[model samples]
Target: MYYIGIDLGTSAVKLLLVDEEGSITSTVSKSYAVEYPRPGWSQQNPADWWEAVTAGARELMAGVDTAQVRAIGTGGQMHGLVALDAAGEVIRPCILWNDGRTEEEVCFLNETIGRERLSGLAGNIAFAGFTAPKLLWMRKHEPDNFARIAHIMLPKDYLTFRLTGEFATDYSDASGTLLLDVEHRCWSAEMLEICGVSEAQMPRLMDGAEAVGTLSAAAAQELGLPAGTVVAAGAGDNAAAAVGCGAVAAGSCNISLGTSGTIFIPSDGFRVDAHNALHSFDYVEGRYHLMGCILSAASCSGWFVGDVLKAEDFDAEEAASDPAVATVDLPYFLPYLMGERSPHNDTAARGAFVGMRADTSRAQMVRAVREGVAFAIRDCVEVARGEDIRIERSTLCGGGSKSALMRQTLANVLNIELDLPETEQGPGYGAAMLAMVAAGDAPSVEACVGRIVRMRGSVVPDPQAVAAYEERYQIWRQMYPALKPIYRQMAR
Candidate 1:
């Protein structure tokens, strides 16, 4: 009994092979290309994803016994649009989660369609990167292709379909599509009508750990795995990462800082914000979670160090930031490098350093990068607080979490203890755990997490620093709304 998890990411498909005991036996990754036809647009060929997965699977199990493989699960980037025609032909390259080409469609949904109505129907409002807006964008801009669509899919769902020969998706993935009634755990016909689509175009939905179907013959042969390997209904990348970090229980939180950053607060009952800011999505545990995401996080640091400063060694660059080490706050920073999402759904927004002076040092600039991400995340935490959710502590995992300075910054900024997981394998680990549960190797997702995942250590917030960030966070929330109209105009 073994399981393989495929993490279909923005740039690559990461394949992980794990035994029944949660030990990782093999790990492989294959990168793919993303095309940008326009400045704000991002797309990837479904063929590219399939090729990477097939190649990665072969590499991951080359020396292992493929016969022992029991199940396959996925954790993938959310809200990317993948379309196929009646004959199952790839209609076009998928629009990615970071694609901002659907601003017009997003405006029409949030303004004309009304956020309240959209939230009522789907438990969340539309964002430019959501699959539904991408659908509308296709309908408006690529009418010929839209006319031929027989099946609509998300990024990872494309992989699942190729593996299982089943046109199905999980609730967590569907929730980000702006087409699902997340509370009801089903497609919203009203939302479909609103988007000028129908239920026929959607896939059958399931919880993340449920078995969708067995692997197809072609897929099994390509990957050198058993033909009957169970393909579980996998989750969207964030949800998968949450489960990977064992953030499935009520009141548990996991912060992800990839190209985008998110604060995922897991809960048992369903809840939506009055402003429709945070998303209420179905969790892998058959429960619900509230999430808030910002489009740019660590990428801001990369940009500052690589592009702005023309420096490559980020660690060396960060180590120079003495101002952030003890008791001083950077005077200015706004890390909206690629617009923004969550509390501020402004695609027109741009990044800036507002209060810089002649005295601003390279270290201070670096510290600003660290502090800006923290302040932005705290914005989402405030929204969660307004909902009466209390987060005394949180689990941290991500590239950003690797920075001791950043971890300390986040811990204090949020005024909470940040715990690191024992098996912090990110999304792939969680997906493999889900596959184990579906394969009957584990009793449940919760049980498997309790058994396999452990807390390594904790980063505690300093009361003094928390007080400093509280003052800065209060100021950070003001800058966005004041900058909103400017962002809108710039988008035009």
Candidate 2:
């Protein structure tokens, strides 16, 4: 049996083919444009997603035995609001997850509606990216369109619909909507009322491994697959990555640093942080997970190396960065180029270099970018620790994990060992594993991971490095608090 996993990302749809043995046979990607009509607003057409996916799938299976393909799953960008009219036509370009256009709506829910009330109803509070807030923004700004709405879907659920002709979503994806009673694994009536939307507008809730349906004839012909290929209700990208890293067990963790960075911690039962800094969401393991998202992660490094520094030799620059200069406080940086989430949900926060000195060298500044990212990640770990989710070691995957300096810093600054997965395909690999479970090729997600997910090696923290990072981390924690007031003032 063969499974295909699609990672519906912010910039592209990445398709991966995995054989029964769990080896990735082939991988293909197709990019789509993200529109920014207004500052702080982001949108994308659902049609671009469909086209990329179908085209990518054809290429992914170009030389493979199509007859062996049995199931399809996806790890999708979460919390984008995709609306449909009565005839199932897209109402508008989806309001993407990183968009900040719903700030008014978020304030209404977090303040007027009240945080405690929202949390009680949805097991989470409103963030600008959440679906419920997006619904409010639409109702206020696009009332005519809201009245014509027949369906409200997340990004991947939209793809699932096009494939199986089923209006369905999995718990892991639904958890980001702020419309689900996450603890109960169902939509919250209170949330719907507050958002001025209806339950009928939402996709039918399905488990991540539940077979949404066999592919429709129309979809089959377009993608060159069997007419009845099984389509599993897939997970949000982070949860799927968790499944990929074998982080389904309690106390297990997976850190992904792609467009955004997150610390994912799985739990058997639902548990929300008292302050609501951490997001409590359903996991692909048929359980729950708590996640802290940093809006800027690897993108920060990409911007610095590829854009600002114009340096092609990233490895060479990393190698040139001396740890001795890292000891100086002259090159401190905060990784908030595109605003922040996770520990600080402030979208208005701006990036800064607090301790810049005339003596600061270009290499030290480069090292600061790497170290700053690691510090931001540790900020998330600090929030998790507050909630009693202890972390002595964690499995890591992401573009950032490939950097030896960053990984070593993560191990020491976060003060934990970082286990690296052998099949580091991340979310795409996990989505394929979900397909395996849906196809009945595996008993459970955990069982599938144990058999297929291999451990390559682990990065352990040296006592000296840990001690040094502890001092810097103490300083890192203070930077946010000292700068937070300025962040809000600038926003005003």
Candidate 3:
């Protein structure tokens, strides 16, 4: 049997065709645009996502035996709010996950509503990127649109609705909404009330590997797949990627450096951090995980290289970078381009180059960008460490992980062994595994991953690099606190 997995990413829809044996047969990607209407706001059209997924699926299954396909699953960007009207039409362009337009709402929830109260209701406290804050932002600024919202879902669930005509979401994805009582794997009544949204507006919650519904006839025809193919309730991108990396067992760790960076630590049971610095969310394994998210990761380097420098080749830039200069304390970068999330929940924070000199070369800046991301991720690692979770090794995946410098930098900065997966297709590969479980080809997520996921190699931290990064990381930590006042002032 064949399974189709769709990764509804921030910038593209990646479709994968996998056979029962766990090998990716074919893959296709379709890109879309993210709109930045204002300095800090990010949004995207839901129609564009639908068009991309359908087009990519057709291309993915071209000349293949469509009848052999059994199930379809999706893993997508989490926490983006997608509202629909009564007629099931998109209410507006989706308020994207990286959007920082909810500072007021976030402050209202974390301060006015009280962090303790919010944390008790939802496993997490309010962040600007969370769905509840977005809802509050809409209610106050765009009341007409808020009133028109008959349905509320995350980015990937929007695709699930398009494929199966089902208003449903998986636990891992729902966990990010700040409307879910993540401990119970259900929507929180108090959170719903706080957001001024009805429970009816929420999607039905399911396990990541469970079937939401079968593909609708129209959707099947559009994608050139069988009408009755099962549609699995997929996971959030990070959760799905962890599963793909075989990080299903308790205490397992996975680090991702996609648009955002995250240190995902799976737990066998629910465990919320004392300060709520890290996100406590449901894992794809039907348990829990602690995640520390960095708002900017690979995107930081992409922006600096592609936009600012007007250069397309990242490898060429990295090749010329002086590794020796990276050890010095003069030049440092804060990867808060879209504001920070984990460790520091400051939305007013902006990216800055703290120290530079006349002789500072573009190569040195490139090295700074890469090392800056590594240092930011280490911030989250420290949080997990505070919770008494010792992470000695972790599986790594994502666009940034493809960089030898990044992988080694992360290993050295965090001082952890980094395992490289054989097939690092990210969430799409795990979404396909979820499809296998939904179709009864696999017993569970654990079993599916056990059979499919394999470690191809590992990157061990260099002792000298680790020592140098330890010093630099301490200095990097001081930069954020020192700039907090300035960041707030600049926001005005």
Name the candidate that leads on TM-score. Answer: 3
What is the TM-score of each predicted model, taking all chains together?
0.97, 0.98, 0.99
Candidate 3, 1-492: lDDT as tens digits: 899989999999899999998899999999999999998999999999999988898889889999999999899999999999999999989999989999999999999999999889988999999999999999999999999999999999999999999999999989999999999888999999989999999999999999999999999999888999999999999999998889999978999999999989999899899899999999775689999999999999999999999998889998787474246655888999999999899999888887899988898888888889999999999988988899999999999999988888889999999999999897999999999999999999998888878899999998988898898888889999999999899999
* Model 3 CA lDDT for position 453: 85
TM-score winner between 2 and 3, please give it.
3
Clashing pairs in 3: none
The TM-score that candidate 3 achieves is: 0.99
Listed per model in order, the count of residue pairs whose N, CA or C atoms clash below 3 Å is 0, 0, 0
Error of 1 at 394 (Å): 0.8
Model 2, span 285-322: residue lDDT tens: 56899999988888887888889989999888888875
Predict model 3's lDDT versus the native. Answer: 0.92
Query: By lDDT, highest first, what's the ranking?
Result: 3, 2, 1
Better of 1 and 3 by lDDT: 3
Worst 10 residues of 2 by lDDT: 322-331
Select the stronger candidate by TM-score from 1 and 3. Answer: 3
lDDT of 1 by residue, 238-295 (tens): 8998988988999789998877899999988899987888888888767999999998
Report residue 262 deviation for candidate 1 (angstroms).
0.6
